[model samples]
Target: MKRTLVIGDIHGGFKALQQVFERANVTENDQLIFLGDYVDGWSESSQIIQFLIELSEKQECIFIKGNHDAFAEDWFSSRETPGVWLYNGGKKTVESYADYSPENLKLHLEFFQRMKNYYVDEENRLFIHAGYSSMHGPEREVYSSNYRWDRTLWETAVAMDKKLSRNSNLYPKRLLLYKEIFIGHTPTLHLGVKIPIMKANIWNLDTGAAFTGALSIMDVNTKEFWQSDPLPSLYPAERGRNK
Candidate 1:
C-alpha cells in the first residue's frame, strides 16, 4: 500500500530535508504532504524551492502555506522588507536568491501563490501549517490569517485534561471536527520534546529544524517517523534561527 507522509516545517534546511527523506526510504509511490515554512532560516532557501519544484514533477505532493511562506511571498511581489520578517530569518532567504534570474524568481513566487492554507483529506484528517480558530472548520474561518498564524488549536490540545473524555460536555468542539489534525509552525522543542508530539487528536510535526532540532517526517497511517540530524550539526558554520 502507498504511504501518506506528513512532513514538518523545513525552514530552508535543505540538507536536513534530504537526509530525512533518505532515512525514511521515501518512494515516488508515496504521497508527500509538506506542512510548509519551506524557506527563511538556513542558507539554502532558494535551493529548497527549486528542488521541490522539480520533485513535484516526479510524484504527488501537497503544499500547505505557513506564515513565513506568506511573508516571503509578499516580499517577492512587493520587494518591501518587513523588519519583523528579517529578524526572524527572512534575511537569509533574501540572500539565498541572490543568484536567481528573474524567470526563476517568478516561478518560485508562483509556487508560493499556489500553496493551500489548509487541506482536509477523505478520512476527515486536516493538514495545516499552523492552527485554525473556526469551530466549523477552516473553510468557515473568518480570519484567513488564523490558518497560518493561530496557535490556540494546539495550545488547547496541549492543555486539555487527559482524563477528560472526548464525549464530555466540556470537551472542545473544535477537536471533534476531524479524526486527526496534523500541523507544523509550533516547534515541539518548545515543550522540551525533540520528536513529533501527539496531544489529544492533534499531531505536531515541527521538530524545530529552523533551530537546534531535527527535520522530521511521519507516515500518517502507521505513525512511523524518521528524522535527520539536528539542523545545527548539519550546518556547522551557520547559526540558523537559533540566534
Candidate 2:
C-alpha cells in the first residue's frame, strides 16, 4: 500500500509530533512531509529542527517554509536588527541551541534556506506551506512568499471560485495547477469547537495548534486524518478574531 503522511504546523510541539506518529502508527515505509513552522511558539525549536533533520536523513521528508520559519531564516541571514529575531520566536529557537556556537546557527540557517516551498507527488497532490492564488505562476517560477504569506491571495481565489490561470500573476490557478493540494498556515477551526471545515475537499490540517488548537495530519491517498489533544499552553489564553 502506498502511504504518505502529511504533518501540520509543528510550532516546536515535539510531544504533539510524537502523538501524531503514535496515532498514525507510522513506520519506516511511510513517507513524511511537514508543512513547516517547526520552530517558534512553544519551546524546543532547535531540538525539533534537529530532530526533523535527522528524520529527513533516514526517510523521504519534505519541508515547507512558514512565516515563523522565514523569520528564523532572516535572523540567521543578518537581514534585520538583532532584536527582530527575538520578537518572532527566535528566542526559543536560539535557546534550544544554547550549547552550540555561531557556526551551528549558520549551518541551521543554510538548511532552512534550502527547504522547498512545496512538494508535488507523482499523483499531482500538492503539498505547500500555504495556499496560492490566481496570481501565482508556473511551478518553477512560483514565489516563496505565496507559500509564506498568501492567505489573502488564496482568499481571492476562493472568492472568485475559479483557478487563476498560469499567465495571471495576481493568483496562480492553484487548483488547476494540481489535482489536489495539502497546506498548513490557517487554522480550519479552533480546537474543541467543532471546526467548520472538517473533512472538506481542500484539506487543512493545522487544527490551530499554535493557539488552543490540536495538531493534525491526514493520509492523502485515503483521506484518513488524525489529530492529537491540545498540548499544554505556552501563552496566556487569547482569542484571535478572524475576518
Candidate 3:
C-alpha cells in the first residue's frame, strides 16, 4: 500500500540508508520525506547526496534541511569551511566530494538549495528536521534556524509526555499546531534508544546515524518502522569523524 514514509537523519551512512529503504520496500508510490542531515557522519556523505538526487529524480521526495545541511550549503556557495562545520563531521563530507567535477558540485548545491525548512502534508502532519515553537499559525514562524536547530520544543514535548495530567487543559498548546509532528535533529539514541521515540504525538526519528545508532524510516500513518543494522557495524573500519 502507498504511504507517506518519513526517514530520520542519514548523516552519510549510505549502507544504512539502502538497508532501511529496502526494508521498508520504498518505491515511487511512496511519498518519501527525508528529515535531513544527509551529510557529515559516515564516510559516504557525497555518495548519499548523489543517491538522494537520484532518488528524487524518480520518487516524490520531500527533503527538510537539517542544521548540518545548512552548514553544507554554506560550503557549497562559498567553498569556505567554517571551523565549526569542519569539527562537526563536516571534514568527512568535504573529503567525500574532494574530486567531483565543478558541474556535479553545482548540481549538489542545487539539491541542497532547494530543500525546504518544513513540510505540512495533507494530513496536517508536520515534518521538520527540528521542532517548531511557533504559536502564530499553521504556516509557522520557525522559518529561521529553529527549523533545523531547535531542541527546546522537543524537550518540552518530552516534558509533556512525562507529565500525567495531559488533559485538554494540561496538554501543551504548542504541540496542538499539528495533527502530529515528526522531527530528526535530536537523536533518540541520546534518550537510550536506537529507534524512533514517540511522545505526545511528536515522533523523533533520528537514531544517531552521526554517532553509533542506525538510520530509521517510519510510516507516519501507521507508526511502523524499519531500521538499518547498527550503523557502526556498517563501516567497521572507520569512525567517520563523528561529533
Candidate 4:
C-alpha cells in the first residue's frame, strides 16, 4: 500500500533533506505532508525550495506555511530589508537566492504563496506547522496565524500526557479535534535530543535540522520514521540554531 509521509522542518540544509529522502525512500505515489519552516538556517534554503517544487509536481505533496516562511513572504511582498528574520537564520535563505534570475524568483515566490496554513486528511488527522486553537471547531475563532505561531497546543498535549491518570477518562478538548495531529516549528532538541516527540495524539516533528540535529520524516499512519545523519556531519562548516 502507498504511504503518507509527514516530514519535519527542513530549515534549509539541503544536504540533510537529501539524506532523509534517501533514507525514507519516498516515492511519487506517497502522500508527503511537510510540516514547514522550509527556509532559514543552513545555506541551501533556495535549493531546498526548488527541490520541493519539483517533487510536488510528481507526488502528492502538501506544503504547510511556517513562521519563517511568513517572514520570507513579507520580505518579498514589501521588498523590505531584513530585521528579525536575518538574525534567525533567514539570512542564509536570502543569501541563497541572491543570484537567482527573475523567473526563478517568481517560481519560488509562487510556491510560498500557494502554501496552506493547515491540512486535514480524510481520516481527520490535522497537520499544521505549529499550534492551533480548540476553542472554535474550524468556524469563527480559528486564526491562520495559530497554525504557524502557537505552541500551546503541543505544549498542552505534552503536559496532558504527564498528567493523565487511570481514573481520568476525559482528554483535552484540543486533542478531540482529530484522531492525530502532527506539527513542526518547535524542535525536539530542546529536550536534549534530536528526534520526533509524541505526546498523547500529537506529534512534534521539528528535529532542528537547521541546528545540530537531523532531518526527520515519518509514516503518519504507521509511525515508521527515518532521519538523516546529524546535520553537522552533512554541513561540517555551518553553525546551526543553538550551536
Candidate 5:
C-alpha cells in the first residue's frame, strides 16, 4: 500500500538524509512531506537542495518552508546575510553555493520560493515547518511569520494536561483545528529526547540533526519511524550548529 511519510528538519546533513531515506526504503509509491530546514548546519546544503529538486521530479513531495529556509531565501534574493543567521549555520549554506553559477543559484532560489508555509492534507492532517497561533487555523492566521516561526502551538500542546478531553472547555482551540498537526522547527532534543515526539495531537519530528541528533522520517499513519545515525557520526569534522 502507498504510505505517507513526514520528514523532519534536515539542517544540511545530506548524508543523514540519504541514510534515513535508505533505511526507510522509500519508494515512488510513498508520498513525502518535508518539514523544511533543508539548508543550514552541515557542509552539503547546496547538494541537499539539488537532491530534493531531483527527488521531487520522480516522487510526490510537499515542501514546507522553515524559518531557516526563509532566512536563506532572503540571502539568496538580496545577497545580504544576517549575522545571526550566519552564527546559526547560514555560513555553511553560503559556502556550499560558492561554486554555483548565477543561473544555478537562481534555480535554487526558485526552489525556495516554491515552498509552502503550511500544507493540510485531504485527511485534515496539517504539515507545517513550525507552528501557527490562530485558534481558527493557519489559513486564518494574521501574522504570516507565525507559520514558520511560532512555537506557541507546540508549546500549548506539550504543556496541555493529557487528561483533558477534547470536549473540555479548557482544551486549547488551536489543537482542535486539525485532526493531527505535524511540525519540525523545535527539535525533540530540547525536551531531552532523540526521537519524534507526540504530545496531544501534535507530532514534533525534528530530532536535532543540526546538533548531535539524527534525521528522522515517520509514517504518518502508523507512526513507525526511521532515523539516520547521529549527524556528528556522519560528519565528524563538522560542528554543524553545535557552536
Candidate 6:
C-alpha cells in the first residue's frame, strides 16, 4: 500500500505547510492529498498557489476545494457578488494578486474553479474539504454538498455506521469502505478537542492555522502527525508583507 499523507487547510501559510511536509518526509511514491482552503487568511496566497502548482506537476498530489477556495474562485473570476469574497477573508487573496491585472485575475479564477470537490482512493479513503452525512448517502455515495457543508450530519452518521460496522461488518464490503475520511474547514477547537488535532475518525486537521491555531498534517496509514508552532503575533507594520 502506498503511504499517503493528507494535509489540512493551509490558508496561505506556505512556510507552515512546508514544515509539515518536511516532517511527514513525503517520498516520490507517497501521494499527498490536500484538503483545501489553500488561500486567504494569510498574506502568502500567491506564493502558496505557485508552490502547489509546481508540486502538482511533479508528484501525485490531489487538491480538493474548500469554501474559502470557492470564495477565491468567485472573487477572482468576477462571477460572484462583490462583497462576499472580501468579507470572507478574501482581502489577502486580492492583495496576493496585486501585480496582476484583470486578465491575470481571470486566469487565477479559472485555476481555482478547476480544483476537485473531493477525492476517494481505491481504499475508499474519502478526502474532502468538509464532510457529508447519511443524508448524502453511504460512504460511496457522498454528495458535493457534503464537501462544502454538513459536518454535523456526517459526524452522526459516522458514529452510528462505525459502531454497526464494528459489530456486524455488514452493509458494504470492508475493503471498499474507508478506514477513515480526511477533512478540513471547521476549526477543531470547536469540535471539543482542547487543542487543534485530528478527531472523529474524520481527521479535523484545519487547526485554524489561518487564525489562532497552528497548521497541521497527518500520515494516513500510521496516524503520525506534525504541526508548525503557533504563528507569531504580527505587528500592524508587518501584517501584509509576503514572507
lDDT of 4 by residue, 1-243 (tens): 699999999988888888888888877889999989988888899999999999988988999999999988787777675777888987788899899998988888889999998888899998889977755533343577877998888787766757674346676666777888899988898777677989888889998787888899999878889999988888788885543
Instruction: Write out the backbone clash pairs for model 3.
Output: none
lDDT of each: 0.95, 0.69, 0.87, 0.84, 0.95, 0.69
Local lDDT at 6 for model 6: 81
TM-score of each: 0.99, 0.79, 0.95, 0.94, 0.99, 0.79
Q: Tell me which residue pairs clash in candidate 6.
A: none
Q: Candidate 3, which ten residues in sequence have the lowest lDDT sum?
A: 134-143
Q: Whole-model lDDT for model 5 versus the true structure?
A: 0.95
Winning model by lDDT: 5
Comparison by TM-score, 4 against 6, better one: 4
Candidate 6 residue runs with Cα over 4 Å from true position? 79-81, 101-107, 134-143, 154-165, 168-177, 192-200, 233-243
Error of 1 at 186 (Å): 0.6
TM-score of 5: 0.99
| lDDT (tens digit, per residue) of candidate 2 on 180-222 | 6677787765334423233213566677766667788788777
Q: Clashing pairs in model 4?
A: none
What does candidate 5's lDDT look like per residue over 107-201, in tens digits?
99999999998999999999999898888999999999998999999899889888999999999999998899999999899999999999999
lDDT of 6 by residue, 153-227 (tens): 335534455445443545433222466777788777565552435433556777777676677877777877888
Which tens-of-lDDT digit does each residue in 36-133 have in candidate 1?
A: 89998999999999999999999999999999999999999998999999999999999999988999999999999999999989999999998888
Q: How do these models rank on lDDT, best leading? A: 5, 1, 3, 4, 6, 2
Model 3 per-residue lDDT tens digits across residues 1-243: 789999999888999999998999988999999999999978899999998899898979999999999999999999999998888889889999999999999999999999998898888888988876677633556458788888877898787646555467767777877788899999897789878998887899998888888899999888899999988899998785453
